[model samples]
Target chain A: MKLLLTGSAGFIGSHLAEHFLAHGHEVIGVDNYLSGQPRHTRHLLAHPGFSFVEADVSMGLPTDTGPLNWVLHFASPASPPHYQQHAIETLMVGAQGTQHALDLARRSGARFLLASTSEVYGDPQVHPQPEAYWGHVNPNGVRSCYDEAKRYAEAITCAYHREHGLDTRIIRIFNTYGPHMRPDDGRVVTNFINQALAGEALTVQGDGQQTRSFQYVSDLVAGIAALMALPGPHPHPVNLGTTDAITVLRFAQIVRDAIDPTLPIRFVPLAADDPRQRQPDITLARTLLGWSPQVSLTDGLTRTIAYFRALRAEQQPVPTSGPAWMRGAADAGQSAATPGD
Target chain B: MKLLLTGSAGFIGSHLAEHFLAHGHEVIGVDNYLSGQPRHTRHLLAHPGFSFVEADVSMGLPTDTGPLNWVLHFASPASPPHYQQHAIETLMVGAQGTQHALDLARRSGARFLLASTSEVYGDPQVHPQPEAYWGHVNPNGVRSCYDEAKRYAEAITCAYHREHGLDTRIIRIFNTYGPHMRPDDGRVVTNFINQALAGEALTVQGDGQQTRSFQYVSDLVAGIAALMALPGPHPHPVNLGTTDAITVLRFAQIVRDAIDPTLPIRFVPLAADDPRQRQPDITLARTLLGWSPQVSLTDGLTRTIAYFRALRAEQQPVPTSGPAWMRGAADAGQSAATPGD
Candidate 1:
């Protein structure tokens, strides 16, 4: 298969590109690095199956990325602070970026997948959100730049599928963390791991009582690989995340234990429009895709902590060399070597 | 004041352009005629203070729309049937159209207005939804092309105001019906009026028991004019809809009585994702804009019936001449002469 993946310089996207390439598929990756780290793409450039295009998908796909079998849109800044800082760009990338990617897939007669987020559930009124749940979203709030934009992206993706006979898939991803997450990305998992590794107090938002379901990146991309390979008109959105819900404080403790148990916890004010509870009911994914997360919270943390520790040890913002922990993440988590390896 | 109005050939936009022109304001009206009827602007084009630009706002605002004090973005396929028929274009217009209009406003140092809709509420969970009620919307449903698009528009509009300090206003317009509405447009008011006038059974969706609030176009334009004229950093969205909630059955009966007392109603299957109860809590509009619906249902229906009757009698689809009933809407409902006059 030939594939075009947007945001391939980012965490999930880079992982997706590697997975497809390892499966003997040709992959063309595109990104402008607005929020993505270039070092994530460094290893993939060595793979003969992977090519790179540096451009913003909001304008359009670059012309030279020849015909494709599939186009996966995984662009846009995912974290709250990053999206808020580039609100206009985030909104543009999500809406226009998704449109351009869908257009490319339509023209190429390729199946399309849009990497949406659980943020669409928006402070879930339902304990475990199903795809059937219509979200409670603020259209003009500060977080709306990301939330509303993703919703709009989902809307446009479905429009293309129904109106243009385009094959499309949407995965509402819950929190996922592993190798390649930036120390400054402001996501909770990286924040705690990096803080613990740095021997600083782990900063937890608010009371840290709010629960979240976190999926390991290997588990997430594993689900993505299965979905891309599965053939059907199976057009509905699927939830991809661990149902192993945990409180922020408890998750911070786990991270601290993995890196350094002596690290203290620092509490901070919660951001606006933050979701109180997030957990996905992966009934459809389990039944239809026959997929469930494999990586345990403990093992995933041990691996992610190693990557950040190596990152800190290398003294580069995003390490240039393919550290053993990073390679372990790319190998679908089988490798158990420590960062020193 | 000089104003640039996108969708000026649209039903609400034409009325708005006329209002501003009558107040000695120069107006540049733009439309692609995707959903807007060309005849809606026939009268406005005659005014020395008014000019027309035929272009899609989604592509970009036409280059020739001169200097302006305000830019009102009202260009999208508003009716469900029309939007569904042009689903992709509708989505494009709402997002890109809104962005282009905002960019033009930013460049020209003009205040901006976004013509959002009650549809943004998307089958409200709260009765008489306030501006603060985060809406209940289906991101992948059939109606999402319009609903999510408008929500995206609102997000970007707020982004412009917050990030760039551009003055902006958003009005969540409820169902508005008046002279310029396409006879075939699927809105309940226009549908009922045209059906009764054509001596056909009024088509009512579902059981005809669902409640909806309909605002007269004159009342709506009056609110818009007031909001645009008054000056401040007033940034929150305002509901410019009426609280005159009525059942579809009762509204159909009123339309029938106005046109032909014996006309019957034909109930039809409900639309997918249709709002069961829709009524705006317009307290914000009443206090901030000093506005309320001045046209009673009876009066508004009477005028709307006259316009459709005039349309049917003319035997031309979208009659080109500016009939008295049409002029009455432009005058903000002061003209009371019968269509025969």
Candidate 2:
């Protein structure tokens, strides 16, 4: 099968591109690199099954991208700080960008998969949000650029499916972390990991009691692939994330133990409208796609720490005068303040 | 002031256009007549202050209609049945149509007023929703086309305001009814008035216990005009409706009493995702714009009934065989089966 994947240079997108290539599918990747870094997909650039295009999907997709069986739209800034910085861009990508992808899918007779987010359920009133839950979201809040745009995207996707009989699937992704994450992405996982690696104070917000369920990137990619392989167009949205819940402090501790156990913890004020907890009820994924997250938090953190460590090593040569582990610690600390999800 | 008002042929828009014209403003009215009727604006065609442009704002605005001092985006199917029928169009008008209006506003440096609805606070958990209440909405439900579209419109309106420094105001309009409403618009006011006028049984949904605060169109127009006259951009959303809440059964009784006190009511199942109760907290509108609804329900219902009666009389020639009041009763009964709101 051939696929057109957007945001293919970002963490989740790049990983999904790799997963598709590994499964013997040809992939055409597109990214304008607004929040995505080219280095994330540098290795995949030379793969025989992968080809890349530099373009913003919000404007339009390339015309020359040949026959496609799938169109995966994951083209917006996922983290709060990034989206807040590029608020208008985020809104456009969710609205126009999704429209472009859906139009492409409709024209090519391809299955369209929208990478919707758990943020759609903003500071959710319901626990372990199910696909059936009608979210409690502020349509005009600071986070609305991302939350409302995603909601609009879902609405339009359903509209196309109902009006034009276009094949579409919506995956509401929860907190996902692993390799390829930007060190300063402003999400809790990357924030804690980078702070721990640098031996700096790990910042937890508002007593750090707020909880989240993190899904490993690989698990999310697997769920996406499974959903894509299903027989017909599944118009209903499906929750794709691990059910295992953990407090923010516990998550920070796991990262600290894996990287630097001696790192001090710092408490900070939480951002306005920050969710207290978010856990997906993925019964639909289990029943229909027969998928569940397999990566344990401990293993995921270990592999992620190894990746960051190797990244630091490559950026700074091992020093003969001081401890080799401390060579890139200073730079990591400098850039660790911008944590991402 | 020169104003570009979309949906100018619809019930509220027509009244608003007249309001602006009466205040000595030059008005350029645009409508595609999707849910709006041409007959509603027939009187305004010859008005020196008003000019009509037949175009869908969702597609694009007329370029030649120069210099807009204010852009009022009021283009969408408001009533549930009308919106549900044109679901895709409604979504596009809210998303793409809103974008077009904002772009126009930004380019012309005009104040943009978004006609958002109380449906943004979908099936509210709060009794009287305030501007501060983050809405509880279903992103993929049947009514999501209208609710989420309005939410997206608000988000994008704020986006344009923050990003381009475009002056913007959002009014969360609650249930409103008056003259020029389509007899079959499927709102409770029109529904009950039409049924009562026809001397047919008024159908009340779900024991008629659900409550909605209905604002008269003239009061909404006054509030909109006051907001438009404010000196600077007020980006905050304001709730613009009455606090006088009444149950659907009570509302039906008022309509019946005005048209025909002997009219019976039939109970029926409510529509999916219908809000059991929705009343706006207009504290912000009162403080910011000094606006409040002044039309009593009884007076509004009487005027609405008179309008429908006149319309029925015009459409069907009254026979001399029976009393003049019973002349148009047969047609009203024939078309009163479909309940609205």
Highest TM-score: give the candidate number.
1
Query: What's model 2's TM-score?
Result: 0.90
List model 2 lDDT by residue over B91-157, tens digit each: 8899889999998887777899999999999989997898899878888888989999999999999
What shift in Å separates residue B150 of candidate 1 from its native position after superposition?
A: 0.2
Docking class of 2: medium
Which parts of model 2 have CA positions greater than 4 angstroms off?
A: A63-67, A317-341, B63-67, B317-341
- Candidate 1 overall Cα lDDT vs. reference? 0.86
For DockQ, the strongest prediction is: 1
Question: Model 2 chain B, poorest ten-residue lDDT window?
Answer: B332-341
Give the alpha carbon lDDT tens digit for every residue of B132-176 in model 1.
Answer: 998899998999999999999999999999999999999999988
Q: How close to the true structure is residue A309 of candidate 2, measured as C-alpha lDDT?
A: 77
DockQ of candidates 1 onward, in order?
0.81, 0.65
Which run of 10 residues does model 2 chain A get worst, by summed lDDT? A332-341
